[model samples]
Target chain A: MEGLQTVGSALLTLGLVAVAVVLSLYERLDLEREIGVAVVRSFVQLAAIGYVINFIFGLENLGAVALLLGGMVLFAAWTSARRAGDVPRAFAVAAVAVGVAAVATLGLLLALRVVPATARYLIPLGGMVIGNSMNAASLTLTRIRDDLAEQRPKVEAALALGATSRQAVAPILRVSLQSALIPLIDATKTTGIIFLPGAMVGMIIAGADPLEAVRLQIVVLYMLLGSVSIAAILVGTLSYRSFFTPRHQLRKGVSG
Target chain B: MASLKIEVRGLGYGVCGTEILNGVDARVPDGEITAVVGPSGAGKSTLLRAINRLIEPSSGEVYLEGVPTGSLDPLELRRRVGMVFQIPALFGTSVEEAVLYGARLSGGDADPGRLLEVVGLDPSLAGRDPQTLSVGQQQRVSIARALALEPEALLLDEPTSALDEAARRKIEELVRDLNDRLGLTMVFVSHDLSQVERVADRLVLLADGKSVGEWERGDFFSEAGERARRFIAGRL
Candidate 1:
């Protein structure tokens, strides 16, 4: 009966998804198949990850934990790299930016003993940091490419008048960094008032103390803010070079 | 004999198997206005860019005053050879800021008021906002901005094409005056042959991405210059 309660509740959430599918059908949205597929995929993926995470939790080895964290970073980088179309060495750039950002934030967290050195705490927090930073790095790379291409004439005018590549692109870099960080900035600003964040909601559902859940959610939000900014700044600094020649000429057709 | 200030020797550029400038050659005389006249896709702008190392030529070298441009730092070369585009791409907000941009970048200094006067704009125009000015006025501002760098040569890429007839004539007069009074070496790209005759000391014809013929202004449209005649008639 105890285990059945947990299983029963999980199965009940399917009813919420069923309602969404029903609404899609009523509206003639033609999205019922997509909704069903997405729900099934999410269920299978989460179930697989749940089993894998539980097994790692039992082992309690740091190496296994580190390996899982590395895999998560690689997957996050790959996912973000897709958005960085036509950025030279985009995968490498995204990986380095996301990897460094994740490590820096996660290392500081562990060193400070903010989160316990267990799979339960580390995996979720690390995932949050990596996921947020991936979005940022991806945005920065895309903006840099698009803006540079769009502003080629102004850039070349500056270059033609003895301006360095750095001087010419400083404006674009500023805008890209601002764009990459704004989403996270807004999320941070509206955290508690606008919406209760997912981490805290998950903790509450798992029956953790409400106050404990709030405290953990605050730490998660702070980590995202820090790591996302780091990744964005890093991507901007690294990717601007790809748009110019060594002689400071704006490369031909840099935008995707 | 007039010395050649800018020399394009077999200049070529191609990308992804399409040739833009195919071993083009031209010689721009010092302290004179050399007008490059051609139809669309003639590579006139590309050749002008190569002279200042703005666009590196793939197959040949460009020399400025007999010094191989490849030997100079690109920034120094660009400073010595100013460029004004077809559109008046004025950055920042006001006219004065646009005028001083090159000077600021190169650590040189020029009075905005005087540069405006040099470009035939009123001194007070410097204080006005760039958006408030006409397209012709904006082009003058961009030209003045280039002049602030004290460049040895100026590349004008169809500078008057966007202007009305009155403004076009004014800019044409300005180009002629600049060469006559200041001895400024200018390579101007133009579509109108009459404008070329009004301002140019020499005419360089470009077609099929190469220089097909060249002549002094008097002979360009003269009866003896059959090649030039055929070119004007769209036969060459």
Candidate 2:
């Protein structure tokens, strides 16, 4: 009877929190209609995630875990490419690159005992790294595309003057990739001094020692930095060819 | 005949079966300012684009100095033939950067001061952002950029169409001066007949994707075909 009461109380509390979130979003974005849609989507997604995570924890199979991680990477890549706009097969490429890079880096850290190999440690940490890298890749690709469109005349003139496609877009490509890495660099530089990052705070709430939490957070930070940098550079370089042809002319209908 | 700088023979371009330039045949003489004049949708710009392979020719061939342009590498072809657009298109944070972009890409060294001077711009404008310049000034900076490669032929598509009369005269004078000083082969495209007369040594009049008439600049005004005359009078 007491356990049932405790569960009932927890349900009430969760319902209230959901209401509060909806009300807050409504107030902040002036989006009354969006609140209901957002709440429903969040509920469905979170519930689905709960089931999947529970299954993974129960099975604890390496292949299953790898498949789940791969799916996340593919989704991240698809979302990033969608955001970047009109890249020919770029989303698939970005997905494979970000997924492989993020998962491999985080997996190595786990194997090296830098972070715990438990599902709790591995899943969230891998997700965070992959998510951040996806953002970096998306931003880099978008900026490069926009810069190429805006600076087309200069690019054409360059081509006319004996420049290959890579040479033609070198200036904008350099600037775009550098700008994409700035946020990750800044976050790393200011990690502890500026704020207590989510991982450290979460660890503390879960009753870990403060020093231990801080050490793990540092590892996560460095891992993210490495993963995102590599993803941004690779995605930027590979995606550039999609914008032009083998003959170095801008591919018609590719530009948004 | 003196070597033709550019020869477009029966060129046509289409996208998804929609033709843009149809059967365009024209010869641009060496060291002559040949103006391609036509109204909107007459394929004036498309003709210029075909010459440098900016727009692929679906049916015909373009020869640059007797070598087929389609045979040469596009980058190498572009290096010898340069294009300046209708609107002054400048990129980068500063004028010098935008102008030098072409030279840097081509692996050539161009004196920014000399290039700016040739375009009738003050050397001090070099350090300033091109976005801050007026329309005419930006166009001059674009001219400087195109000239950076010392291209054998320059293609201008309504280069002064976006400027005021005062700016127009300045650009016109600059074009004339560039032609005389450098003996550059120029293919100038314009909708304005008077501007064509002022600049062109020879004229190729286009209408509905076809070359309607060809004549020397003076003769084009006097002995032009009825369709060409009507086009000039804005009657059709």
Candidate 3:
């Protein structure tokens, strides 16, 4: 019984997914097939990513790391831009935000010698920061666009009273940024109590010392907080101008 | 009082394929109320907004004090020609903050209490949240917010359409007082011809995005063109 060898481990994972499918059928929930498909996709994608990361780690070259990180940022921006529907140059805007924040944060960490300047350390840390900041940028941009659309009267009222575009949308901008950061803030506040975050768990599973894992986890959390804050602010500030015209008129049809 | 404060020449605005204002031409005298009266979709609001550059005209020019609006910084222009929307759209949480919002943005010294007093509101109401105020009071706060800028001209878009009779009369009195005391040029969009006649020193009739006719307050009833007459008689 060797405690589930490789083949047995694979089947055990499949069996766990089967439980959800069975329960879904018993409860008449329509998500049985979706659950199955999601499980399979996650397994396949993670396996593919594992191999890619292994290859990337073996490269140990600065160019390869930079190219990979750039690709990740481009893809992240593309996904984030979907949330900012109808906003002009949304992809470019998100790319700039996520790219700048992730780079700046990682650069600072590397300069401080907190993270080594190698593919092994940089790739994972940059990926984590970029991915979280992407989400923040997407949420903030989408929220700001929607708020500007819904609150046209409020914005124009401010404009009519000689407020600049920046002044006109300031309140909504503040709210959007606050809303965008709320999820990260809450997760950070309840980190140990609610659940073990992914980075710490991954470190522990890799046989690192628990105390060392906790320290790395703290750095990851702080990095995410700083990077996401920058991302949200950049996205929010850059996107508001699109809501107005050259003559300072509020654009009524705020769409593609 | 007779100098031209706002001159709209061949102003046109179109959205997509539909024309909102088709070459509107009119002049607003300084220190006088110019009532723009038209039927629904006559581009009354568009014309007023165009004056303040809130809605850019597709082809035309708006001159404030004989200077083209295009040449000035829009923010600066907007400060000079303040506007009030149909609905009382206050920005900040409290009434005092709302009144001060514009003034602060324009880098002006805004005395909330004095602005409130000028708008006929009790100075104590400054501390209350604008959301808690009655619609009429909110509308007054809107006016005070605009006046805080100490603008040379004022644009009102159906300022009383949402209010009751008493509230409407109060706003009308406030408008007249502001005009007389400040000598501010005013362009007010209204559907109510009676109110226009009662408070406006001059009247401009717009229909189908064009200025059909204009007259002094005394002559509008007798000398309005045929189409404006139909609109006045509720027959258009």
Query: Candidate 2 on A19-100: residue-level lDDT in tens?
Result: 7667878678566566658767887887787789889989877677777778889889889989987778778768866976
The list of candidate 2 runs beyond 4 A from truth reads: A1-10, A13-34, A58-60, A107-113, A116-120, A185-195, A254-256, B91-98, B121-134
Q: Which sections of candidate 3 miss by over 4 Å?
A: A1-8, A16-37, B223-227, B232-236
DockQ score of the complex predicted as candidate 1: 0.77
Q: Model 2, residue B176: displacement in angstroms?
A: 2.2
> Is candidate 1 or 3 superior in TM-score?
1
Rank by TM-score (best first):
1, 3, 2
The residue pairs that clash in candidate 3, if any, are none
Residue-pair clashes per candidate? 0, 2, 0
Q: What TM-scores result for chain A when each predicted structure is judged separately against the true chain A?
A: 0.90, 0.85, 0.91
Query: Against the true structure, what is model 2's DockQ?
Result: 0.53
Deviation in Å, model 1, residue A145 alpha carbon: 1.3
Choose the strongest candidate by DockQ. 1
Clashes of 3: 0
The candidates, ranked best first by DockQ, are 1, 3, 2
What TM-score does chain B get in every candidate? 0.96, 0.95, 0.95
lDDT of 1 by residue, A1-256 (tens): 2333675688888999889989998999999999989988988988887887998999998788789889988887787778887778788888889989988998999999998888888888888888889999888998888888888778889999999999999999999999999988998899889999999987888788999999998899888988998999888888888878888887766632
